[model samples]
Each structure stands twice: as structure tokens, then as C-alpha cells.
Target: MPAYGLRSHAWPVTHAVTELIAVNAALTPGRELYLSLRHRDSALRIVVWDQHPRHADPDTRALCEARRSTALWLLAAVVDDWGGEWGSGEARPPQQGVKSWVLLPQ
Candidate 1:
């Protein structure tokens, strides 16, 4: 984040990634977790993918309202925007996974 002139966002970004990893690990023990960071002209994107094919999608309104995890709540508050989707087996040929991403404006 600092590399992209987003020094102020570094801590929040790190916390978001750590929280995502922890949540994935707790929910799907032993499953693989993947993290990706991308810098765009206007935003920085942080994504975490986990090998939990059948887990609930993070996009549902009900899940957002019912979420009891303080880490997730904090993550949502810190990031400018966030969302997730379940990767299709055909699209993610190597493994079916759930992808969660946070976007912070640059």
C-alpha cells in the first residue's frame, strides 16, 4: 500500500488480510488460502481466496447483517468497499474456492 502512495492505509490493509486469513482458517481448517494484492490507478485491491467450496458466500445481505465476527466488522469498517463470490469449478479449474476482496481508494 505504501508503494502505491497509500501509506496511511497500510495498517488497515494488513489487518484486513490477517483477519481474512484467520476467518478462513477457522472455518476451513487445513484448507489452502491465497492472498493477492493489486494496485490500480485509483484503488488498491486486496483479495483472499480459500479452498472452502461449500462455505456460505460472503455477498448475501443476510450474512452481512448476521455476521458476529468482530474482525469482519472491523474489516468492513476500514475498507472503502468489500465483496465476495464463489469461484466456479470451470473458471477456477485448479480448485473451486471462495474469493473475498477489499478495495481501498488510492
Candidate 2:
């Protein structure tokens, strides 16, 4: 396994690399961030979770929004060009955060 736990054969989208950069730019400083990259069903899955203030909380949603970087706009272009799907949602139970993910067909 590679340092990031991805298989040796796994590779990122050469032209859609902005996804990772945008996710990192949106993260909360000093907070925990988890990343997972894997190949499944002939596609590449990339997920990034951040321990930022949950968007479901109205008061903190603004805080989280304020932390978002304009760089995230690049994700749209990348996804469109690659025919990939990307979205974000609340983390699952036991995890209070957000997860942004993208799926790109191989």
C-alpha cells in the first residue's frame, strides 16, 4: 500500500486534480481531515472529510461558509470536463463533520 493507503495502481485524474486542491482549501485550519482514494467498479472514488463546524448548525454554517475558498469553483469545471460526479454532505453517525466526494469513471 502507498503512504495514503491507496493501492499502487490507483491514480488520480491527471486533469481533474483541482478536486483535491479545492477540498483542502475549504478545510478548517487546525482541524482533522481524512482522505480516501480507491478504485471501485471501474471508477475512481475520492472522499475528503473535515472536522469543521457542521453546516446543519445555522449559527456555525456561516462560519463554515466563510472558510470556503473561491478555489472550490474549480471543482465544477473539473467535474464537468471529466464527466465525473461530485457532491458534499454531512458525515455519517459518530462523525460530526462534512464529507465531499467525487466519482470519476475510468
Which one wins on lDDT? 2
List of clashing residue pairs for candidate 1 = none
**What is candidate 1's CA lDDT for residue 12?**
70
Q: Against the unseen true structure, what C-alpha lDDT does each candidate score?
A: 0.61, 0.64
- In candidate 1 the C-alpha lDDT for residue 21 amounts to 81
Model 2 alpha-carbon drift over 4 Å, by segment: 1-18, 55-71
lDDT of 2 by residue, 16-106 (tens): 4456545654576677777876777877787777776655678687656544534456765777667778777678978767777778776
lDDT for model 1, on a 0 to 1 scale? 0.61
Clashes of each: 0, 0
Tell me the tens digit of each residue's lDDT in model 1 across 18-43: 87788767655897888888877677
Worst 10 residues of 2 by lDDT: 8-17
